[model samples]
Structures are given as C-alpha cells and as structure tokens.
Target: MTHVLILGANGQIARYAIDLLLNETDAQLTLYLRNANRLSNLQSDRVSIREGDVLDLATLKEAMESQDVVYANLSGDMEGQAKNIVKNMEKTGLKRLIFINAFGIYDEIPGEFGKWNQRVIGQYLPPYRKAADIIEDSDLDYTIVRPPWLTNEDEIDYEITQKAGPFIGTVVSRKSVASLVVKMVESPGLHVRRNLGINKPNTNGDRPAFME
Candidate 1:
C-alpha cells in the first residue's frame, strides 16, 4: 500500500481529497494538521492523524517517515511552510510532493478576470509565489497545482492549462481539484515537475460567477 502524508489536513480541499482517497484508493494516509481533533472522526486502520505545525521541522520530519507522497494543502506563511517541507523531505529522502497554490501567482490569467483577480487578492500573491518558487527550486519530484477561484459545487468538471500558457476559466469545484489530486497520488509519475492551472471549462468572465 502507498503511504501518503497530507500536510494541512484540515483544509477544505484536503478534506475533499481525503474522502476521495479513502473511497477510491487503498493508500495509507498520515493527516498532519495543527489540530488533530478536527479529523478525529476519520481515524481508522488506514488513517492516522498527527497534530503539529508545519514550521516545526523536527515534528514535520518525523511525519514524513515511510511515506511515498506528500500532499500539501496549506495557507498562511506559505514561504516558510514550503521551506520547511522541502528541508524535511530532503532530510528524510522522500521525493514526491503535491503542492496547492493560486492561479495568478505567475500572472498567467488573462483579460479582465485576470486584472480583477489581482485587485481582489493581489496582496496574498507574494508569499504564494515565493512558496511556488521554493518548490520549483527543489530537487524533490513536485507538482505545483494552481487552482482558480474555488467553489463547493458537487461536480468534478475541470480542465488543465500548463504554466507556459494563459490560464483558462474563472472557477473550479473543490471536488474537481480533489479528483485531480487523487489522480496524481494514484499515479506518482503523473505531472512530475509540472505547474498545472486548473479551472472549470467555459466559465471565463470578468470574475467568477459567484463574485458576479
């Protein structure tokens, strides 16, 4: 069985991914978060919860043990968190990582929606971009997932754009992103060293529908 370590396990996207991973795959999971109690209900033979902050290098390294993949669904102090994850993973000799980030980090979103995105969340981009840069500079096999504005819709309708191209669409469902994450977990070789932009097809506009 594959052993996957999930950082920021309590994140909304991580929650969706966890449910799908449990239902669709036989991967053993180590759910690492600041509060273990948040995921206590998920404890089972294949699921283990670890309570510790990502900035805690010693604890983070310990959690990386015997794992095949590391999926990070995190926010706040992203640069610091990314550095710690890279450092810990290097020390522990774990190579595969799946990291979540925002779409406009590369200014890849085009047209009015792109400008609108910057106006709305421009302040948060520096740290997220720094985090992405950290992962990109690392030797660990990594996939940087750039998801557009997210929604809670109960569907998995989405598409992918490579980093070199303009990003498409305005929003994608959380379930869509989760499905993509699970697909990456199931096939470790998939999208290695790639920065993916995920969005719902044909939803392009000046802003996300919800925002409009």
Candidate 2:
C-alpha cells in the first residue's frame, strides 16, 4: 500500500484530499501539521497525525521516513518550506511530490483577470515563485499545481493547463483541486516535473465570480 505524507494537512484543500484518499484508496496517510488538536477528531487505522512545523526539519524528516509520496498544501514562507522538503526528501530517497501553489506565480494568467489577480495578490507571488523554482531545480519527481481563485463549492469541475500556455478560467472549486490531487496520488507518474494550472472552465472574467 502507498504511504502518503501530507504537509499542512489542515489546509482546506488538504482536508478535501484526505477524505477522497480515505474513501477511494487504501493508502496509509500521515497528516502533518503544526497543531494536532485541530484534527483530533480524525481517527483511522490508516491515518496518523504528526504535529510540527515544516520549518522543523528534524520532525519533517522523521515524518518522511518510509513514505511513498509527499503532498504539500501550504502557505507563508513557502520558499523556506520547499527547501526543507527537498533537502529531506532527497536525503530519504523519496521522489514523488505534489505541491499546491497559487496561480499567477508564473505570470501565466492572461487578460484582465491576470491584471486583476496581480493587483490583488501580486505582493504574495515572489515567495511562491521561488518555491516553485526550488522544486523545479530539484531531482525529485514533482508536480507543481497552480490553482486560480478557489471556491468552497461542493462541485468537482476543473480543467488543466501546462506552464507553457496562458492559464484559463478565473476560479475552481476546492473539491476539484482535491480530486486532482487524489488522482495523482493514485497514479504517481501522472504529471511528473510539470507545472499544472487548474481552473473551472468558462468562468473567466475580470475576477472570480464570487468576487463580482
């Protein structure tokens, strides 16, 4: 059975992905986050919770041991986190990494929506871009997911674009991103070394519909 380690396990998308993984696959899961009490209600024979910050390299390495995949759902100081993840994963000899990141990190979004996104969130893109660069430079088999404005809708609907093209759409459901993550977890080779842009199709506008 695959053993998956989830960093920032309390994140909204990681929570959704955790549910999907438990329901759809038999993978053993290690949910790593800063606080255990937040997820104390989560109990399963297939799950374990590790409480520590990603910046804590000793704990991060301990969690990576014997794991088959690492899925990171994180924010704030992502560049530092990426460096630690890469350092430890390389030491542990683990290869697959599915990292969640925000859209526009690559200046890939086009048109008015892109401009709007920059105006609103541009201040936050530098660290994310540096994180992406760090992961890309590593030898690990990694998939960097860049999701556009996210929503809490119950629906699962999304499309994907590679880093080579302009990103499409303005928003995507959290459930949709989780579904994609579960898919990759189930099939490790799905998008290795690729930067993926995910969004709901045809929702393009000056901003996310929810913001309008």
lDDT of each: 0.95, 0.96
- How does candidate 2 score on lDDT? 0.96
For each candidate, give its TM-score against the true structure.
0.99, 0.99
- 1-212 per-residue lDDT for model 2 (tens digits): 99999999999999999999999999999999999999999989999999999999999999999999999999889999999999999999999999998899889888999999999999989999999999999999999999988899999999999999999999999999999999999999999999999999999888888888
- lDDT, candidate 2, at 151: 90
All predictions: root-mean-square deviation over Cα?
0.6, 0.6
Candidate 1 has its poorest 10 consecutive residues by lDDT at 35-44
Q: Residue 5 CA error for candidate 2 (Å)?
A: 0.1
lDDT tens digits, residues 1-212, model 1?
Answer: 89999999999999999999999999999999999989877767999999999999999999999999999999999999999999999999999999999889989989999899999998889999999999999999999999988999999999999999999999999999999999999999999999999999999899999877
- Residue pairs with colliding backbones in model 2 are none
Q: What is the lDDT of residue 78 in candidate 2?
A: 96
